[model samples]
Target: MKETYGFKTVPITLRESYSASKNGWSALLLDDKNCKEPYRSKKYDIEIVDRVGGGDSFASGLIYGLLEKQNTKDVLEFAVAASCLKHSIPGDFNLVSIDEVEKLVKSGGSGRVER
Candidate 1:
């Protein structure tokens, strides 16, 4: 499909099994045809306050990153981080700002309280 469509990369979100400490989620990025390995984002530790709108948040973040001209890896990271954060908030809307999502991405989704 990628070859037929001439896509540069494809990003997929995987919902991992829950562990004793946290629920895990990851994003896989497949690049060009000759690429041997896909770039994988770090597993995000999700508390999962609400699962609704998680996918939407991820898609929105991906679009935002692409619109901002972020690199493939960065875009994947941003999307996954946004989705992770969405799981912690109640309701169907993702209320987080870009700064919050970027902070989560850079911090590796540690869930630390920011002062």
Candidate 2:
């Protein structure tokens, strides 16, 4: 843990895992202050359009979630969801609103435009 090395211990640790078997992405977040069992997010099956700003988007979402004072589960889910949506956008920027990311996080991400 970076906290052990005199670093900021905000989220503690976040690990992103890619599952070739499921063809999707899942994330694990560990923060003792948040939950007893490590918080895990449901897999996000997204189409990769552009990976340029995926990481930055995740960090942006994480900051927003923290600012919103969300729980550990919701924060991690929002960050991961935001990053996944970035991959589906074809540019260097993640042009998604909070509602878009929240919709994906809450609705299990169908990856389709609603009618």
Candidate 3:
């Protein structure tokens, strides 16, 4: 598609797996020129509190990251982390702020409460 349509990049989200206590999520970012291999996020193990709106949260995070002019890798990580955090909240909407998502990304989803 990049060759035929002159596309530069494409982003894809994957629901890697799910178990009784945890759900896994990943993201793949393909950029034709800069990235030789697809940029991938580390598998995030999210404790599931609600299943609804996870995908929406990911999409929203991606869009928000892009709008905020974050780097490609940071954007992907932020999106996955945001979606992972969404699973821990008991609602259809993702209520996490960018700071919270950034904290998750930095802390590697440790599930520790901020004091």
Candidate 4:
């Protein structure tokens, strides 16, 4: 798909809750460099205030990372972390800043965000 589509990287969501008891999500990044990086979000075990916009938040974070030209690892972590925090929010709109997401991504990042 990457070759045919000329995609530099392709991201696929991993909703662990669909298969397991844990309500968390992860992501898979298929890089054009023949690398498959799996990024699991931190901040799992959080009580979800709202279940809306998880995927959108994830995509936003990914976009932010890409726009900022961050590293792949950081990008994935940011995406998952952003989505994780978004779940704690009470609305479909995510209001978190770049700093907050970076903090979450930097500290104890890459695991799974529990809902």
Candidate 5:
């Protein structure tokens, strides 16, 4: 089907969660060799005034990474990083720049803290 559409196809897995105990949602980018983990996860952060559209933000970031032809690991990292940034902002748009996402990718989750 992908070849028919001329799209660089990727598989998407959706897990069903009926557990009210589940406090958050996440998405994982799957490829050969277990290349990445779930891209986003939130354990009920107290600061979030609005929970709507957060998943859309994650989807945006993942799609952005894929458009850049990022490797599975980088793609997952970018998505999660973007989602993290999304948490700090108040809007429908994630509003994170590609360079910022790249910085986080390069830092391997341990970037410097500049105040």
Candidate 6:
């Protein structure tokens, strides 16, 4: 994976699996510190139009947070929250605001009402 992605070394917490009959796989990235967050928030409250670009949305959010010099915790929260919000819509792109992601982060990814 590292060689393909042009990395010097593989991730220390690396994992990989394949299924001959399966078509594809899903990836869920979590920070050990953020384990308290839910695996998946309420779906009835969300309307997912597309789920294709969620991964890219997450990466972009993480990168943006990191570039802003946000703390590791904030970065992870923003990234995951952005990814989650992306699921509420269709397509590969999630049109979300950084503030929205941060709001979800502040609420612990519950998608609760913001004060």
| Number of the top-ranking candidate, with lDDT as the measure | 1
Per-residue lDDT of model 3, residues 15-84, tens digit only: 7466776756788877664466788986776668897998899888888876674467777788788888
Error of 5 at 50 (Å): 4.7
Q: Please say which candidate is ahead in lDDT: 2 or 6.
A: 2
Local distance difference test scores for all models: 0.77, 0.68, 0.76, 0.70, 0.52, 0.51
What TM-score would you give candidate 6 relative to the actual structure? 0.55
In candidate 1, stretches whose alpha carbon ends up further than 4 angstroms from where it belongs are: 3-7, 19-22, 31-37, 111-115
- TM-score for each prediction? 0.81, 0.76, 0.79, 0.75, 0.55, 0.55
What TM-score quantifies how close candidate 4 is to the native fold?
A: 0.75
Over 31-54, each residue of candidate 1 has an lDDT whose tens digit, in order, gives: 563354688888866667788898
Query: Least lDDT summed over 10 consecutive residues: which range in candidate 5?
Result: 38-47
Q: Once model 1 is optimally superposed onto the true structure by TM-score, how far is the C-alpha of residue 46 displaced, in angstroms?
A: 1.0
- lDDT per residue, candidate 4, 1-114, as tens digits? 676988878888766563323465667776544446544434354456687898899999888877774467777777888887887788898888878877777668544333
Off by over 4 Å in 2: 6-23, 109-115
Comparing candidate 1 with candidate 2, which one achieves the higher TM-score?
Answer: 1
Error of 3 at 3 (Å): 5.7
Clashing pairs in 5: none
Give the alpha carbon lDDT tens digit for every residue of 1-115 in model 6: 4337653211111112233321221223333334433233221133344557866776787677657733455655566667667766667677777777777767754544232
Model 2 CA RMSD to the hidden true structure, in angstroms: 3.7
Taking all chains together, the TM-score of candidate 1 against the true structure is: 0.81
User: Which parts of model 4 have CA positions greater than 4 angstroms off?
Assistant: 18-22, 33-43, 110-115
Relative to the unseen true structure, what is the C-alpha lDDT of residue 87 in candidate 6, on a scale of 0 to 100?
64
- Residue 92's lDDT in candidate 2: 88
